[model samples]
Target chain A: MRLIHAATGEGFNPPSAKDFELPPFIEGVDWATKPILLAFLSVIFISVFFIAASRKAAVVPSKLQFAGEGVYNFVREGLGREIIGHDFLKFVPYLFTLFTFILVNNFFGIIPFLQFPTMSRVSFPYVLAAITFFIFHYVGIKKQGIVKYLREIMFMPGVPKPVYILLTPIEIATYFLVRPLTLSLRLFANMFAGHLLLLVFFLGGEHLLNGVLGLKLVSPFAFVIGIGLTFFEFMVQVLQAYIFTLLTALYIAGALADEH
Target chain B: MNKDENALWSIFGYLLSGLLVWGGIGYFVDRWLGYDRVFTLVGLLLGMGSALYLVWLRFGRHSG
Candidate 1:
């Protein structure tokens, strides 16, 4: 509130959702934006790092291999095996890819010069959630025949006959609509809000520099808070990535359950 | 711990979907009938009650 109070005539313009609309990298091509480029770059980085790490297999592991395995084992044991259980091996590859891909793209938020989280764009998260939606449904159908799966989702056992009319609709909506909708929205909101927070402090600090001497002295505090928030944003970025993958694994595990 | 977390999320999901779907239906029904907002409140209360019952069935029943 005091931010706008400091400037008398020309009030400080704080950052908003409009700031997220980044311009295209190529003027003529509409789709060629910074986030898209950064997404592709992340894919390449992950692919190369993993391939190089595994290329030279040795009993005594090197640094790259150790780092690669560390990430792999984390997903495999912590997420896949612990969450999915039993036939968790089959799902590890998907979980691993989801985890690393999200982690790298989210890290782009604080990575200098390329400070844009691709997932901050709603479309990216939507697509990722869609993939997860299809995969989990497919797994369920494959495991328990389509008829049984639908029956399980549509009708909960031990419920009174009349109650089905009320509970069934909620169950269907939760599974089909809310599940993926919440999944994607959670990631998109986190990245979008985190990016906006940093932009506010930094841009506000820059704007303050042009004001009177009293405001100018206060600018450094804004910059300092921005720096501190960047570190907090790092923790958020990592946690969001983990949660996204964890939820995906949980959904898959739920699908694979015989008695829903 | 993992199972507890899973249950919590499912409970949250069920509660949210319950309110949204039923309250949404009630809103449209009210609009169609040209009533004020009577059905919407009824639907919301019904949804919250049913969602709690569903949660008890899924999670609470197993505890005791």
Candidate 2:
């Protein structure tokens, strides 16, 4: 009976070996290698673009100047001045660099061959968050002494005494714990999820087109969804970059604000 | 305003407006993507982490 059971069809139906294969994109790279490579490439690309664009500057503005200035003003006037106030000129370069870098890298995610979103890597977002974090807080403390800064973040002047106790802990936790995490994760998750969805639809479409008989009928629907998602992904790519920069500015404001 | 006060206000205004703008973008992206809870959860974590890190560096670190 034992020998018969061992030889039975039920046990013979082993899982398909194909299930163990690595996806095409990730087949060669060592641990998180693709993201790192993409990030380095993005930096180089951005650096070269900026250096070339900024090589010549004119009062009347050349095509390069126009393009550069357009982005500069978009962030500086549209985002920076509107949020940080007119005195935001000091931080415009940093904001400009941040916005352009993220935008270009996010764009790189969708391009073939380099199909990874660099910001989807936790480390990249974390580094950006850390930089913004330091800038705002440092400016805050420098402007308002340590004691005042603490009071500004922790204590609201108008709240009742009992409420103050409750509010203080909540405020402290929200300000100190919650902010940076959300900032990094917001960019990370959007890019991560967006990339994943694109991958699923795209690969699903490809598989359907190439897979079993009669299953090919489903390929058109999958292909349509894939095409639609590509457009949607493009919008998200721009939106996420804008949000990352906007949030960085917001945190800076919160740190420097006298009240909540 | 004094130079310091001007600087502080400048940063504050930028940060506040920036947050609202980005926060709105995040909300819309989540809505459009249809992830609902997942998007909100991730956004919350990212936003909180960013805020906390900024605060720590500002107050915790001695060197500017």
**Chain B TM per candidate, please?**
0.93, 0.54
lDDT of 2 by residue, A1-260 (tens): 02233554533222232222224456665553666667778889878877777788767878877887788789998777877775688778888889998998888778888777778777889998888888888988987888899888776555457745333554565556556767788898888778777776777677677767777898888879878988898899999898778877766665666654
- For A104-151, candidate 1 gives per-residue lDDT tens digits of 999999999999898999999999999999999999999999999999
- Alpha-carbon RMSD to native, per candidate: 2.3, 12.7
> Chain A TM-score for model 1, please?
0.95
Chain B alone, model 2: TM-score? Answer: 0.54
TM-score of 2: 0.70
Give the distance in Å from residue B37's predicted Cα in candidate 1 to where it truly belongs.
2.7
Worst 10 residues of 2 chain A by lDDT: A12-21
**Candidate 1 all-Cα RMSD:** 2.3
Predicted structure 1, TM vs. truth: 0.95
Weakest ten-residue segment in model 1 chain A by summed lDDT: A1-10
- DockQ of predicted model 2: 0.04
